[model samples]
Target: MTRSHRYRSLLLAVSIAVPAALGTAQAADTVKLGLVAELSGAGAPAGTNWRDGAKLAVAEVNAAGGILGKKVEMPEYDTQTDPQVSRALVQKAIDEGVIAIIGTVYSGSTMVNMLVAKQNSIPQFVGSEAPAIVEKGNPFVYRTSSGAQKGVPALTPYFKDTLKAKKVGVAWVNNEFGKGGRNVFIAEMKKAGIDVVVDAASEQAQTDYAADVAKIKSANPDAVFVYMNQEESARFLIEAKKQALPMPLVGEVTLTEAKVIELAGNAADGAIAHVGVTATATEVPGIAAFAKSFEDTFKRKPTHDAIKGYVGVWATKYVTDKVGKVDGEAFAKTMHGLCLKAADHPKILLDTCWDDRGEMSRPSFMVQVKGGSPVVIGTVPAN
Candidate 1:
């Protein structure tokens, strides 16, 4: 080949290959987000929901031209609902250089990952609402949603004043998630002058609550705080109906998820709990259009997970914008300092963005299962 022609070909290769390689090293569009959750086994349902929520947000960001022209990378890991597995998964993500992680869903799993993140100085955005998530003030961790201690307090007073239940009973899975809640609800109820008639624990993943239900029924509680997952929770409610045990039922935010209605059907009726922001697309600004797209794609309605995911994407946009460029530590620190207000939804444009102790400042609300669906009852303050 002629020297001139060969030189031209080599120049073209250099121009194309070098940029491509650098692009690999550099974060693009927004930033790379890593997630650790129980993507399989019993925890898969919640993990899948969490994954979908983040994806909903990512799609919107990409459509709007991404965060600082860098798109979000939502690569995730399956911790299989085991804390040790979650730790290993997060450590792996850190090695691969993910700037932040969205979830390690189960509280037990999150505790494991939280330690790993603290040790490595990696920022982990946990999906946990358990109070223990923030008690340590670990600089490297951020959690979305309120702590059980913070989130559940407002509801207790209501139960005594509004529901007028004299004796309260509590049942939960014997894990960090359940225990975190049992501790707060019991303390708050006692301080509220409500009698604690029943306190019980079940296996973390137990399917049957018949025996537990009978035991709880024996306590004669005027109301009961059920702190199990969606399926078990639904079963408890259904069994309550079957046994003709009559009382008002209350629970934490987990009770507001769509799964409760789907799993329990009419049995879920009359159940009451607090709701984090539930911004549907129409009421939200940029999100309305995005939610429309998700509904068309998924057929089923977009849920809390989808909204959480979208918020992560939107928050990343703010963080990346300030960073001026993408570096792991830089983006992470920016995220920690980020304060956002995204509520395009005209009716319920809930504001849920902040950097307070590395978590969002959500306006918590109360919802009741009126017709097998949650209906807003009251709003709670951030403090």
Candidate 2:
């Protein structure tokens, strides 16, 4: 080729290479987001699932050119499902300059981190569904998952109308999450004219639940509403089964976790539960595709923990990008009035919105374990 032809070719190559290099440079610049999860202890299943979901959201946002023209980076800390450990991690996260925070599967841990975030003026998304977390008047703390007050509305109706259960029993872990769920469930049951025969509470991270199970067995209610994390709940269910306590079992969202079913086996079959998001409930915009992507990426089906975690990241991003800044004050303002629609992502189970209390208003799906998987039975409206 002639000199002029070679010069033209070289110019085209430079033009292409320069833009690619610029894009790579832009992608390297990042804004840090802190993530706290229970990597060990009873809450590991939920923590691991949440971690995968958040990572997927971050990857997708970065691939699409990131938020505010800066690649988002998540620096994670393990809480070991302990409130004290989570408290320390929250301070560390703020000190390390993460713009926002996410997670802590247990309500007790989330409460600790939420207070820290509030004190530090850092925006945090509490992964637990305890009503008390948001009711604490923390402006910096927001929730993507609905708490017991919101989820139990559907649960009580299912017990009263669908199952036609009159007498009921309640057993819960004695924590903020359990208390919130227990209180709301009892109130709703009363309104629906269902009698709560027995109510019991146990310490968190409980292993042997023979005594507790015995109380529930003695109550002999037509249906039971249990409030505990997956691991402990599995143990409780196993013990209940061994004692031949055969009544219709019902529980909170954690009961639908794969780990619970795996541990409880046939004991979990025919169990009813209320969950915000499930692989079997496809109400979100791109749920089918998201599930396929999640399975392809993690080699497991996404659970309520994963779905909520993914939504939390996107919800944070929505506010961050909307305000064109990732500051705590701006986020607090934008997130309060923000209402996201289902068209945003198919994996999102409900249209996202928040009330003045910083609690989410999202629908819950009533599901039953059938053939070793949760099957959607009904959709509960968000009150």
Candidate 3:
């Protein structure tokens, strides 16, 4: 080969090799995200929903060419619904250089892990709606689901005006989630001028609510507000129906889950609950397509937990992209006042990105179980 020709060939090779090396280096700089879930224990169903939902969103993000020139890497751990386990997992994620954390289906676990996130200043996006999660003054924490403070106000009016309920009986599990929810419900119901004649608090995960149901029946409430997990809630409903309590049953978001209906069977019929979204609501923005896509991917309809997680990932991506960096502080600064358009739908579920307190401000919906499915009653205004 001539000297000049050899020189040109070497230059071309150098140019190709430089870009190739840079590409490899860029690929190696992956953005790690931590997903803390309840992959075992009683919370597994909802936790798995959250995990799968976030995974689907991550898949979509990567398929669309990733973010900041690197693929997002989700390092996940199952907390088994244990707060201590969740706390350790949070530290592990932070130590492993994760920029942000998502999930922990149960409120208790989220609260525990979020404290660690606060100490480390790593942003935590939780799926729980307990009022206390955002009340801890942790700037690093944010939520996709509306909490009791937001849900109760919306629920109280529906009980009074929509359902025409006068005297309501209250049943809740005695835990952070149930107590916080009960306190808010009582305060709101009083404001609505509705009487809560029977206030019954049950032990967490108690199987037999026969005694509690009897007291509620003795009060003969026009409607009953129940705040419990799906298993206990279903057990209570089945027993309540067997005794023919006969009043309309109303509850928080958990009551709207398909699992509740499936567990409660015919007992779930005529029950009312507050829900953020319904996959069956075709009028909802992007719900039809989101449902279709989700069913195709998972071969089943997505739950409220799934949708919350999906939105959480997308919301995180929105802020990260807007800031041009995967940073917790930067995202937190702009998290409030930024309106998020959901990737799958235009239903405007998250009307306000987040309030000053880091609580998600979104419209609420009341759904009723008719033929064992959640049918939308109407929208509940935040104010």
Candidate 4:
């Protein structure tokens, strides 16, 4: 070949290679995190709040400067509240090059998808409170709130001392979240020498709770412990109100969430719960500011799931900064036994600690529905 032809061929190779390298560098200049959650289907209330809260935190993070001096990019994938779909989405997020994962708020979905994160050695922050999520020994998986094992036992005192009940009924959705909470509750009741007069299991997204409430009513327990997702909890409360079941209705977590109260309306009144987190705890300056900001942005009150998501992202940032890099393995290693003080990292919004198992510990609340709203009746110290 001629010299000019050879020179042109070399120029073409350089032109192609330079842009490819530049593209790779550009991509590497930003940090991508996946927000995978149940944005639709039965878990929408919790998932949407989670997504919005993460988005809010991401915005603030970017405004202040991003993790490790790289811009933060969050790509969202809707899980549709299906466990298998959530598992697939987690894999997809990792395949797409996300440094970390935030999502699958439904415990069943989290249980299925968290393995994907573990396999990839990607740190995942979840809003799921199922004790089994941490029990699996996945170092990559972490909770934004306390698990049922920790939160439900706090209710034992309320049931045995406050209610003074010898008999209680249990109504739980048969998902991982419900099952874990239900199991812990039953054990606690047994320890307290309280009898479970009725134990009813409902399905996810079960609209009609007439039968479940009927069984609880027939048992005539002193109180009914309602352990279900937000929508199902609302439906159960409405049905219980309609049947005029005279026993007190109590629950943990989902029962007193903003979305549940909104859906159940007056039916939610007189309901009580032990919540790992609540937006109504305005006594905390950080939470009050977060709730107001969330309300202003979303035009609705934030739920406990929202706070979970917000803190999850901020905790990601806090720990990432502590590690001084975005390495997923390092992030996971740093998270175990790490404690974040709100005084140091205001975005975390609370003083929080994590065990080696990635379970979270923070102050919680005992809430009651009054005047169609949740009011914090007491505080539960961190476990």
Q: List candidate 3 stretches off by more than 4 Å.
A: 1-28, 342-350
TM-score of candidate 4 against the unseen true structure: 0.96
- Residue 306 error, candidate 2, Å: 1.1
Give the TM-score of each candidate: 0.86, 0.89, 0.89, 0.96
Give the top-scoring candidate (lDDT): 4
Stretches > 4 Å off in candidate 1: 1-30, 279-293, 327-338, 343-349, 353-356
**How many backbone clashes can be found in candidate 3?**
1
Residues 256-312, candidate 1, lDDT per residue (tens digit)? 567767888888888887756543324336546655666786776655555655555
lDDT of 3 by residue, 1-383 (tens): 99999999999999999999997786477787899888887678778888888888788768766656678888889998788998999899889888888887788888778888888878788888788998888887888788888876778767877779889989998877788889999998888888989999998668888899999999999999999877778888888998899888899888867778888998988888888666766676566766777789998778888877777776767678788987777878887566665543342334546876688876667888899888988887654
Cα lDDT computed for each candidate against the true fold: 0.72, 0.82, 0.81, 0.92
lDDT of 4 by residue, 1-383 (tens): 89999999999999999999998998888888899999999989999999999999998889889887878999999999899999999999999999889987999899899989999999999999889999998999999999999999999999999999999999999989999999999999998899999999999889898898888999999998999999899999999989998988899988988899998999999999999889999999999999999999999999999999999888888889889977878988899999889898988888899999999999899999999999999999998
TM-score of 3: 0.89
Root-mean-square deviation per candidate:
4.1, 7.5, 5.9, 1.7
The residue-level lDDT of candidate 1 at 259 comes to 77
| Residue 317, model 1: Cα distance from true site in angstroms | 2.6
Q: After aligning candidate 4 to the native by TM-score, how far in Å is the CA of 49 from where it should be?
A: 0.8
